[model samples]
Target: MRLGLHALGIGTGAEPAVIRAVAGAAERSGFATLWAGEHVVMVDESDSPYPYSDDGTIAVPADADWIDPMIGLAFAASATSRIGLATGVLLLPEHNPVIVAKQAGSLDKLSGGRFSIGIGIGWSREEFEALGIPFERRAARTADYVAAMRTIWRDDIASYTGEFTTFASIRVHPKPQQRRIPVLCGGNSDAALRRVAQWGDGWYGFNLRDVDDVAAKVATLRGLCEQVGRDPAELRLSVALREPRAPEAGRLAELGIDELVLVASPPQDPVAAAQWVTDLATDWQ
Candidate 1:
């Protein structure tokens, strides 16, 4: 299994030198990708329940910088040559699909096709309200937005008709250097698994703390793929390490996972962060 860093801390107000050091170290150490996560806004606490943590509320600092995922990954891309850059999961329902497709395609073109997109229908009602998007329809909207983006990427003259947005034949220039920019969908629910089978290039299971569930989810995804007539092996499987579950790497690989994306703590100094990553990888990878 390939190893990757789930996050780089430039957005935590870390200095540029630290960002470069972390990205450089990870790349030089043969890590496959550097991923950035997205969130447009956050509050002190909420009843909405942070699905990733043991406690419901997300533990992000009140002052934490929720930088734009693509821009952050673009910076990481500039710092390295070959390491893939990806969004661990960008909140797809919040943004305009045309604009996202342009940005992602531009980054992929600029990075020599080293960009991949991992996406999710966001869970925060407040964030949705803040953006004036209805939270309930986000999943359906996300499906539409992804379809639209794929159309933009795949065609020279792309036209789209969808529930939220539509346009006549128009081309978005500087298409991704790759024939298609890979999009990995994140979530473990039935709807999300179906979305991966239907719309995504891969499955990125979010907040997957239980190792047993990993095999179960993979089984479900493979069964769904067979039902859809898609070869299951063609789909990549990756998981974000929510906390410090250090011993499951081999088990996950045995279950047919393609990648393990480890999360790094937010620290202003890059040297420690780099070393911690190296230590974890040395023991696991």
Candidate 2:
């Protein structure tokens, strides 16, 4: 199994220099990938509850700097050669697929086929509403969006006439370096599993506390893959670890996890954040 790191890069803490330094250090340390999260706009803490956290609150500082993950990864890609660049979870339903496909293809082409897109349907109803996208029917929209993107990426002249999206035959320039840039689906819900089986190259899970539970989820995912006539082994299994619990790494590996993404706590300083990444890489490796 490959070990990697996921950084929130929250606050004014991660400047360009620190990002470059951390990317270089991670690539040098033999980490397989460097992942970052994205939130176009943070919701008002008082009105919107964070789904991932137990307390229904935004954990990071309200003033934390938020950069576009695709742009950040593209910048990091220019600084590192081998480490994979990925969105920890890009809220796909919020953005336009054609534009995303263009940007993602450009990044993958520039990165020499080292980019992977991990996407989710998003959980913030307020953000969706504010973006003029209906909070309901997000899943269906996401499915069509992904399908359209796949058509755009793999076909020469693509045209999608979906319920939500319509485009006449068009060609997206600068095709992805990889024939098909890997799309890894995020979330553990049944709909998410079905999405993985239907379209994703991998399944990305967050806050997986139990290895057995993960194993079961993988089993369920595989069953869905079988039902869809897709080979189970072709679907990569990736999980995010909140902290470095070395004792659990072995168990995770034994569970057939292809990648383990370690999430770092937000740092107060850019240099400190870079050093924290270096230290974690040194200690974990």
Top model number, lDDT:
1
Candidate-wise lDDT, in order: 0.82, 0.82
Residue 38 CA error for candidate 2 (Å)?
1.3
Each prediction's number of clashing residue pairs: 1, 0
TM-score of each: 0.93, 0.92
C-alpha lDDT (0 to 100) for residue 42 of candidate 1? 80
Q: Which lDDT tens digits does candidate 2 get at residues 208-241? A: 6567668788888988998999987888788985
lDDT of candidate 1 at residue 211, scale 0 to 100: 80
Which numbered prediction scores highest in TM-score against the true structure? 1
Which residue pairs show collisions in model 2? none
